[model samples]
Target chain A: ELGPMIVTAAIGQDTSLEDGDILVVTQKVISKAEGRIVDLRTVTPSERGLKLSIETERDPRLVELILRESKSLIKIDSERGIIIAETHHGFICANAGIDQSNVAGEHMVSLLPEDPDGSARRIREEVAQILGVRVAVIISDTFGRAWREGQVNFAIGVSGIDPILDYRGSLDKQGSVLKTTSIAIADELVAAGEMVMGKAEGIPVALIRGYRYQPSAGGVAYLLRDPASDLFR
Target chain B: ELGPMIVTAAIGQDTSLEDGDILVVTQKVISKAEGRIVDLRTVTPSERGLKLSIETERDPRLVELILRESKSLIKIDSERGIIIAETHHGFICANAGIDQSNVAGEHMVSLLPEDPDGSARRIREEVAQILGVRVAVIISDTFGRAWREGQVNFAIGVSGIDPILDYRGSLDKQGSVLKTTSIAIADELVAAGEMVMGKAEGIPVALIRGYRYQPSAGGVAYLLRDPASDLFR
Candidate 1:
């Protein structure tokens, strides 16, 4: 649905995805296309969800959905009314990346796509087949940081691009060996793409051209920090 | 120094900073302009610096500078050789944001700008006077996240633009009342700007055009989180 729909939207708007273009798409539209929208009115809270809802002061049914989506909870600060959970996809985010905003109605909440990397690959293949142009796709979602205030969009899915620009062992302009300078390129590009996407205005996609990224099958999994090295965890 | 040099460089390159354009300048160049660069050979390690250096397996002279620049140590994982400290500017980063990359030589390291927000304002003012065009300026630095791998550029200094966009209390298109959806726009824009900047190539500045950010005097201080609310600390 996403690959065809995105192509249709582009053609309808008199634009085309050029060769070597990176299409940054929001995760909301991808989830919607995958029928991940859930109605809170139809949900019932489990015992643990009910207790957590009371502690966090959230809707019991919504908490149930979040519990279902998460593989483990990292931080449960009842005082701050926050639950930082490791989602099924190994992403640690608040409320398991579930949100009611940008959905159709108040009772509607969307879950993250079942397989975000696969979702991106399918879109890339279909787009290439239809237009005969090679392009990369990224699925982005806004997530809060640990010490930083507010949220910025991060790459949750990727296809046809190496996620990180590994600059370790590379030489700088001054002939100094760069150490530990691998940049999270997919995350940066997604955050860049989010600037053009009007969040409040419901613009879910942005076209980023002219950036020459290393093509690789190594998906967003590369962006997730190894738990052993992560000090905060 | 940054203001004049940046303007001169723009003229040299025959590029003009247009109105509503956000200029993203990396912190390294600003520090270099401000004489924040230090030769590791010139520093004398203190008693505490020597002890910490051995534990963290870092250069004693470099550790001495990091200790002096930091207000407090947040995390010290000797096993990982990672020291997360709160910089004087209130940024929590490794080695208090001291970096040897992008500088003249391996012996030299760049400290973060003393007053990042003021540095941004100076660039904005000088660009306005030279080109008669108003522009927002952001001083950016690459930082590692707690749960994520690699680093994305963040706004450590901001001028002529509000660092955040608060969408709380606004009605969505579905007529639902949104809550707690403030975005760190300055950080996102910096990451976007980093895409064009060749890190290994030593390109320190990037220009972003056509983003309608709200102009404000609220500096990057707004991006720092209150320690009381931060769960990681």
Candidate 2:
């Protein structure tokens, strides 16, 4: 059986974290605290924007923000209401990570926090100073996958944890050339935490215990693929 | 820190699974136990197969098996060495879920177990009967994602866990409706377990504890997406 649950809040201030403790803060809470919400009513849509809305099968206002956030539009399928774009951070995700859920009002949506790695670093520093123990911070959001059944939460920003486990040079039991490298450990952890922190439960945080992950100097940025090296594009 | 490690192997037999205990048997173990491995030397590559591989940039021998396994070929990318086909079980994955890794010797790979869900169910039932506790069994493999950085593991077969968590009809804190909802928790779990078990670590299975997951009556088959409803395809 799992241990008892501990609930806490940011309370407009930083809270310390401990080892084996998983911080499961909601993206909405982080955006609200960081002032990342954008008012949709204040923005104006263009003719190109209206065309994109019809092309993407999304709201015109939402498509306008998505277009602005996008550095490159990879694909747009009007029938499926799907638009894959490269974000400013070089992350290729749907809608450029612009989201309508969990905003304070109807006419507003929140963009992913600018420099999530930076946010995670700041939180880690604050928590370490207060609690005198190390902890890993994962900022998560829901994302769709290609050729999969449903959406799953994944880590957008992470600190104090190695995001990818590279096994390129390692050998399997049979000693054959094992090129199965780069496992996304951090993203999976965020998805696991989302199981307990339900979408509608108002529980923005979850504490994870019993597993110890290996520490690495490499940060979450390593998980971001360089577009030049990407063969699919 | 995590608890002590545990591992189990079914040497000539496919046994049932138990709670908190992981079966470390290889895909070859299960395939051999189920008699699914095909001896390529026994078969001949057809004239049409040779012509198609020249066009598809696929190994003729492998393509022959893939065509046999696939109900239909959805898409083919010769440049990227990818072929998306619908498997007999109606799964649309790369190469019809035929893998070329971790097999017995050179020039041999394994087809996905004939009945993955049934295999998982049988293993779960037998393991429970032996150890007297419920356990989740996942048959995993590495698959590349379209428009993503690196390959991640996904559950090709699963038991004793709900592959997708449906949150439809649920309301957010602000009373907003959640439409088009479900979380693919089991696939995420399989991916997470791969992080620790790893391809080269000789840890084919890792016992996970301290995480509580609710099972669904539909089991892992519920996670399979219908081709008509798949937006990305």
Clash pairs, model 2 backbone:
B16-B127, B17-B127
Give per-residue CA lDDT, model 1, range A1-233, as digits (tens). Answer: 78888889989898888999999999999999999999999999999999999999989998999999999999989976899999999999999999998899778999999999999999999999999999999999989998889899999999999999999998888888888898999999998887788567778888889999999988899999888988888
Highest-scoring model, lDDT: 1
Q: Write the per-residue lDDT of candidate 1 for residues B133-161, one digit (tens) a residue.
A: 99999999989998889888989999999
- Predicted structure with the largest TM-score when compared to the true one: 1
- DockQ-based class of model 1: high
In model 1, the runs with Cα more than 4 Å from the true position are: none
- lDDT against the true structure, each candidate: 0.91, 0.67
Q: Write the per-residue lDDT of candidate 2 for residues B77-167, one digit (tens) a residue.
A: 6776667887887777778877645666667767878877777777767766655777766666666665555567677777767778777
Off by over 4 Å in 2: A1-26, A54-58, A206-221, A224-233, B1-29, B52-59, B73-84, B131-136, B207-214, B217-221
How many residue pairs clash per model? 0, 2
